[model samples]
Target: MTYPHDPIPDLSADRAELFAAAAAEYDRYRPGVPPEAAELLAETLRDLPDPTLLDLGTSTGQVPKALLKALPSLDYIEGVDLSQQMLDQARAALTPVLGGCTLSLVQTSAELYKPLAPLPEEEWWTPDLITCCRAYHWMSGPDVLARTHRIAAPQASLAIMGDGSLWMHEADWTRALRDLVQQFLGAGRRAGALGDCPKPVRPFQEELADSAWSDVAEHRFPVTRSWSPESVLGYLRTTSFAGADLFAERHAAFEEEARALLDNLADGGPLLEETAFTVLLARRRAGAR
Candidate 1:
């Protein structure tokens, strides 16, 4: 399918290095894909006798780890990302759980990645399932989706999913936290060194509708997450909008004030964030590829 829109000018804002400094903290604090989302992905692969997975923006291997738990029969797994630090974390976290499964972690952006040619007699390396969890917003949708269609198996499935970040949650505590971050970093949302958050792209559903993977289904799982003040702080440290690096010398002060605010807000209890984890599952019609 030819995209009607002009080629997007790579609005991801220097993402290759955006998460480099916070990768370890990101792995420690970022939540994994919800279990129901994994089950939904697993359902799509049930018919493939020996499925392989290609995970785009596979930060810390969270999505693969969740899916592996749901579908141990998967034969091969490949993770693509821009940060080597994140891939290193993903390798460490995913290696032990992948009993007998072949794993490849590549350091590259999703749009430029190409699978290695399979060995003689082996089917060409085409993933049966492609997933981009919590990271698709950092990519050029039309370019990535077009590239994905070329690399995926004839009947492959694509899942783009994420829950909004803590920065956007409506809880009173989160609002206070956002206010504190703004005080330190100014009003514009930070996108690493870029200093301004990228504008929101068209919705993923609309992007999918324009691509070859136009047969789409959406599933949303309502999740209630509990966070202590410390966990919330750790998660904040991994975000571009509020990470310590963005705060310069004022990071310590921000954390101190945030801790006090969260303590008062929690009143000796967990801070709760009620969110809906949304998954956009897409595929092409038979022979449409």
Candidate 2:
């Protein structure tokens, strides 16, 4: 499960600081999967025997929290993330809920850690349920799918979900905000310059379809979360475009405009929008040799 390419981003030092500063806000605005993701995850896990779960790119450990809450009998849960700051936040948030369950945190790139090569073989931690929520796009397509196939135990279930419709659902406002940033920062400084846009899941779907997995399933969940204007602005602050250099000069004005936009909306109580998400659930062939 080695990565074919390095997975680290070429983020500036200042951008790294910006990410650390925004860690709390990122957790605040980061929506939990709202019943649908939790339900689907629960259903998928039900088919498996008692499982050791691995949550990849488990930012703030939110999805695992939900999963464990739904399936309290889960014996072991591990969350891996690349960001130390984010992992710290997750540890703090999950500490209270770790009662009677084994919770382990690992800070590493998902690509490099897949198949969890660094783990001791004697640890007896083979995962029967592996779930990645909202973090799959950070992975190169082939790397993630192939890695999933490798690490997962035979007949293990993998569920990958992303908040793909975040911007697409709010296209008009998002475009306006992007245009404004571009206007001030110029064309090449466009937001999401690092290809942070929601990646289509088709490639991974096709990969799984052609792979040896059986009972493959893919489905879309329509979901929504409400956000205050301030919260939404805080969420934007966590994006790559809002690095310290960009945030210092523009964040205040951006907040002002975001508040105004929220006020102008019909409800006038901030913004509520629907988002679409795709969940790919598949099981490795049982007893494949």
Candidate 3:
């Protein structure tokens, strides 16, 4: 709970577990990564005929699903997360696409993952690509990146991705939604599982600069997600801070008021929002430690 690297140390790990409590809601309502971002990820690993990928903090497998669809050449993918419930949804949703590639899920934190290595008869396998979509901030920044660099293949590329979460954006609808959440959960945005989530700075580029994955490049893609008022409410329940469990005794009241607020913000229809999805690609130097 007291991560030395965390900008705000008071944010508890219990807050991060809220997503596990609302795992179903999270699977059902969280936004998907832009398809183009997945394509760019594929391009970044173009040389590998059958790239093995690791999805860090792979919540409900949204990004993995997109990558599977766009990067047909990927042969193996491991979805790692701290919550088994979240991994269950990911496995269920990703089961349909297991035809050409092998899919595996590990209920663990990224900072501690050592790939498949260090286990007897199961040698450690290096991934050609590592993706942490909107999850890097939730991790111990430098530690995870360092582990990723260690497990990655010499030519492996780590993609640290971000497309702002719903609670952090500043659109008119988003601001109004924030106000609604504040009314129930106070002024702070609820992250569902990760407490009082603070955005992680671009730690990878800085960390990678001194590590094996030092060649850095960034690709940005514009994305717009349209959301109905009801959908917004559903999404909020999946978040750590605004989750129903967080509301405790006031959960029902919170939902009712939130629905009402969203309905008013809807202006009789869905809301359109645009945000940038960015991928910071860092490639490991050949044979470098």
Candidate 4:
């Protein structure tokens, strides 16, 4: 999808490497539990029987980890991600959560993975539910949604959840961080090293409606996740904008400065903050329309 900001150089390979290097530090960077995400997962799976599920952009398998805890009878749960390192980490962490359930991790870009047609009379492993958590924006417009519809079974559901104003809670920090990002990008940094800017919900909502899906609905839920200063900095480091190659010479210095700023802004001994998540849910048309 075309981004409003200046186009950054494509550094997908570099970003992958950076994430791999910091994979082990993921939990430390953003340790706060995504309660809202967990709730949505549970809510979506509450009524559905044992069904095949596909999770796109399943970084560290956070969404699936929570869902498995709530629904243990899932026939199969598959996670797809572009970063091998992130997938590796997810597999390790999700093994216990996936006890007795079939779990598979495919290292691939969510936009590129094609879902095969379900076998005749087989309704269970047909991917009745598909979810994209905090990672749908990275997909390229209608193509992603269209591809999703192709793989989903009739009456299947697709949910796209993201922390809409995730970083906007702290206005001061948000503005400062944006400036820092622009400055870094202006210096001819790699494109993939740049984190994606916030996207409005209307476009994606419209895309889902135009795709092979019906009953599209958009909903917003209030949610909060707390993180310490160091953890927050670690989270920032995991972003493409803060990848190793983007700020090879200054990554350490930037982290130091960020830690200091966050430390100064802490409240009640922790850098706690509340944010909201927006979820868009749509059901696949009963028949290919």
Compared with the true structure, all predictions reach lDDT values of 0.86, 0.66, 0.76, 0.67
Show the lowest summed lDDT stretch of 10 residues, model 1. Answer: 1-10
TM-score for each candidate, following the candidate numbering: 0.93, 0.80, 0.87, 0.80
Tens-digit lDDT string for candidate 4 (1-289)? 1111221235256434545667767744644336555666567666767666799888888777877766777768788776777877888888877777877776666767755334488543557788888777777757777787767777678888877432445666555655565665553323344445444566777777787765777777766566677666777666655655566787777777767767776744755456666777888655656
Candidate ordering by TM-score (highest first): 1, 3, 4, 2
Tens digits of per-residue lDDT, candidate 3, 148-222, equal 876777777788888777777888878877787788777765555455656557656777687766788988999
Query: In candidate 2, what are the lDDT values of residues 132-166, reduced to their tens digit?
Result: 88776666656666676777776578887776533
Q: Model 4: which ten-residue window has the lowest total lDDT? A: 1-10
lDDT of 4: 0.67
lDDT of 1 at 83: 77
* Alpha carbon deviation, residue 125, candidate 1 (Å): 1.0
Clash totals for all candidate models: 0, 0, 16, 3
Rank by lDDT, descending? 1, 3, 4, 2
lDDT, candidate 3, residue 158?
Answer: 87
lDDT of 3: 0.76
Worst 10 residues of 2 by lDDT: 1-10
Model 3 poorest 10 in a row by lDDT: 1-10
Which portions of model 2 miss their true places by more than 4 Å?
1-18, 47-49, 114-123, 185-202, 210-215, 241-245, 286-289
RMSD of each: 5.3, 4.8, 5.3, 6.4
